[model samples]
Target: MFNGLSAFPLTPMNETGVDEQAFTRLVENLVLANVSSIGALGSTGSYAYLSRTERQRVAQIAVECAGEIPVMVSIGAVRTRDVLDLAEDAQQVGVKALLLPPMSYQKLTDEDVYSLYQAVTSNISVPLCVYDNPGTTHFEFNDELHGRIAHLPWVGSIKIPGVSVVPDEAKARVDRLRAVIPKHVTIGVSGDTLAATGLNAGCEAWYSVMGGLFPNTAKIMTDTALTGNAAEATRLSRRLEPLWALFRDCGGSLRVIATAAELRQFTTTPSLPLPLRTFTGETRQRIAAVIDELELS
Candidate 1:
């Protein structure tokens, strides 16, 4: 259930709150596109910016709309107790799995991280995916740590973010992780631009931002790579190069995806919190051009 393209839908927001209509439309679109699974309240979903009630609502909505497709919801929190509570909430809402990042305001030791997952897994009935996004969590995972976590009863997958900014090196990182981690545990990659590379390097699944809005394209790329159609996979990934460039230049994927969604008229410009804003006019124009070039609209 965890393996394959796990689409991370952007949480459509307005001044009032989450735009339920738009959010539903986004999930429905992924289902229509036939993505392997759906992920809500992920990094792309702006989980940290939302309230507890909002998160619950989002997870419920995702599960309701996803139907047969499994829904994995992020339940990362600064405190272990809070994480446990969120895990219970997610399970109650019918979420199939929980994605937990060892989030920390301060640096955490290996023991600290292990205990957090152990505590949640011991209590929760659902499977959990270890999200190792050092960029957001500021916590890194070593091979030994991954091995320990993978052996946990409830742990199903390990999401490893592409550490290298370069695509080739990022692909190498996926291969390295595959070699070190337990074979039973699926290795999922999160960097949108490095998805094809990661897949070609033996990563089992893609936790993708682009897949959220462009599931057909993402599925095609993943299938091609997994089937050993390297040429076609590379071709599909190259078509996304322009958008990927904009994603890198604009800081990250949250704003770039939101802007693209707005351009596609999928929703109103995503309402982000302070310290984060939508794209600039020039950036939007570039994104528009790429969208047109790829015929994504």
Candidate 2:
């Protein structure tokens, strides 16, 4: 059922760039945390910035370190052809699954979305997990879209950002969607704050940026939540709330990734893609203070 925590680790980069050694360390650390699964080239891995060759190399490295744990590669792109190419390449990499979301405002109709999904599914043999973050795609996969896509044999999961302007509203939407979707297909929450809520609402899996920084603790919290211990899950989540706040307050995805790497001491030098700026000195201190206040190393 793809139950439990899946840490989406950042693909670390060093002086020479694409620090394979650091990446291996990152993988080994998460493996020791006993993560049920790991995703490569997802948002945290900076997939949108990496060249196709770089993505392939990182996917191979992730698969090598993944061991028996399932590894899923995010194969999304601005173009459908490129998305399918990545999926085909991922199938060759032996990933347990592949995820792709429509991008570049590419589709205006259900037919367009379905055709895009059909092409990727036809090309890839492994299970397909749909990445449904409208925050990036500028397109939301409504319930009808989800029901249509969920019927595909290879479509095994859906990953959606659990963020909302109003918590109650978010819960209502998730609950409604849960009622319609089949119980077999895994529903994964993307953010830490929504992990407990999503699970309580019937989500079976979660992928988190905070998990990448603190894999063991994330696993513990997720395991507790899945076992129906809402009290314990709430306690553990309170501890993570500060960090999640930092991720949100720090402003953008690049800052979140850079701040996480900096806090964890993953790499001395971290870089974010263009059209994004690095964290300021004050913001870094604020992030550090939150970590210290939470007593999280």
User: Pick by lDDT: which candidate is best?
Assistant: 1
Residue 277 miss distance in model 1 (angstroms): 1.8
Model 2, stretches more than 4 Å misplaced? 14-16, 105-107, 163-172, 252-254, 275-277
Task: Indicate which candidate wins on TM-score.
Answer: 1
Q: For residues 246-294, what per-residue lDDT tens digits would candidate 1 score against the true structure?
A: 8889888989888888888778765555466778678778888888888
Off by over 4 Å in 1: 163-172
- Which residue pairs in candidate 1 collide? none
For model 2, residues 1-297, the per-residue Cα lDDT tens digits are 256887888777643558787778778888888888888778877788788888888889989998988888889888888897788777778889887877775445778888888877777778888888877778878888888888777888888788453446666767777776777788888877667777655578887766766787788878888898877876788777777787677654446656656667775455455554456688777777777787652
* lDDT, candidates in the order shown: 0.86, 0.76
**Total clashes, candidate 1?**
0
Error of 2 at 22 (Å): 2.0
All-Cα superposition RMSD per candidate: 1.8, 2.3
| lDDT of candidate model 2 versus the reference | 0.76
In terms of TM-score, how similar is model 1 to the real structure?
0.94
Q: Lowest-lDDT window of 10 residues in candidate 2? A: 268-277
